[model samples]
Target: MPATAPSASSAALPTLLRLRDETFDPANPGAYNLYLLASPGRLCLAVADVERRKFVALEEYQLTTGGVPALAEQHDFLSLRGWNAVRLAVTGRAFTLLPSPLFRAGDELAALRLHHTPTPTETVRHTTHPGLELVNVFAADAALADWLTATYGATGRMLHHTSALLAGIVNQRGAASPRRLYLNPGPQELTLVVLGQHLEYCNVFACTTAEDVVYYTILVMQELGLDPEQDEVTVWGELMPDSAVFSLLRTYIRNVRFGFRPGNVQYSYRLNDVFEYRYFDLLSLHFA
Candidate 1:
């Protein structure tokens, strides 16, 4: 007789547990969506639940030089299909993949392997999902990485700052839960995307300067077949907090009603309730 296949329900349960442990909200029933960020250099794992808009857990690693490279190598296995469920292993500076089953054990073990004791780097033994696709990956500039640490490294500091700013705007206009969203980042620019339900058109521009904002907003509106003079456009990101940038953008983009959505919007290994930060979450928001 052919070997019996593992029960789908059993396999799925582990996936669900991994998802929940890594990103779900036990306090909020029915919360499923999550984003995970892993950085081997820092030995940090940041997990955020998009539904509750909060970071559920965070842990750091203390690895020597030998372990750092070990974890960094696993970047090749990072893919979008897993969503927020992932396992990271690091030995010195080297990177390795962990079996997904380990993710189900809870964040404690995940934390231990990632941060505490050094373990032999083991090869991850599992079949890769056919649907998995590498979406967005980029190198963090040394200066930017340093800046992030200085500005938002403390526990709960970044999340609190982000939530307060965004909650105000999202609540003020009572926008219909943002039907469509997109996030794009270049070496020098980061773009936050919001789209209509049909996705007929999209806004893509850099967040660093006001001119780019106005140019992209107009481009998206025109593409969507909406006149900028008549429709409302809401700009969201860290740059929104800068009055000079905001003013310049508003002046150039005339007649259109504009608003600000504040918070840290970088795609990093940190979760913020206020500003959007996870790389996969940004990708999901756009494709969602």
Candidate 2:
């Protein structure tokens, strides 16, 4: 049977987690920071807490490509007849991970699964605090030129998945939507950062090498209508602590005499500090 969208009362909120490389390592004992992306059907029930850290328990289910039994048969460890809330990391297609009210407290520690009907599509996943809406943007006519002009504006471009996700989050939060978005596939890859609403100007440039940072920084300044030599620009993203990309981007801006600040970006309500929280906050928000 095709899965129907859940009612308001039963809808699942979205959740976002900014995962650091260390968090993925089993050797690390510290609990990883996680934000609830869009809202979920159930609230988390705390089982333990220590040293300002939370150890909460909630029902969790895994969805696969087939029906529940078929999924169970393929995975021997999964319990086909009961419910389970096991720590999990989901990978692969995002659309397959639809919200469902199939889990409940007191159900046994068994695997439960569901599936979505087949359809031709492209998957765009944006991680934010739980409960934030998920928006998917695709080339309307399958032409980069048309997509760019329609979503961001002339000379606008999209170079990273993070920018697109940010645009979607802002629009979902009632912010202005961009008219055109641009993307280029080349060594001198260019990504245009644009504020959807009518702003003073548009930023442009190509990050060919570390030295190209100054050129890019100047472009951003020109777009914001700020004096590159006098004003400062706030930049945020997930890059290695000591990465060539980060150094290049930072040095380029610094040399231009613009005030440069480094910080993590958040896209949800539960954001606190540091890590770039991208997914929807599920604990407090809901999807229509």
Q: Evaluated with TM-score, which candidate comes out highest?
A: 1
Q: Write the per-residue lDDT of candidate 2 for residues 1-288, one digit (tens) a residue.
A: 111222242233221222122112222223222211111121111111123333221112233333222332432222211111211111112222112243233321121112222223322222222332322222111232233334334322222232233333343433444332221111243333333343222222445564565465556556556553444343333234365655665554442211111122222222333333212222111121
RMSD of candidates 1 onward, in order: 17.8, 17.6
| Candidate 1 stretches greater than 4 Å from native | 1-45, 49-54, 57-84, 87-187, 190-194, 203-208, 252-288
Give the CA lDDT, 0 to 100, for residue 164 in model 1: 22
Question: lDDT tens digits, residues 216-252, model 1?
Answer: 6556656656564554555543343445656765565
Sequence-dependent TM-score of model 2: 0.29
lDDT of 1 at 239: 43
**TM-score per candidate:** 0.34, 0.29
lDDT of 2 at 217: 52
How far out, in Å, is residue 109 in model 1? 38
Model 1 TM-score relative to the real fold: 0.34
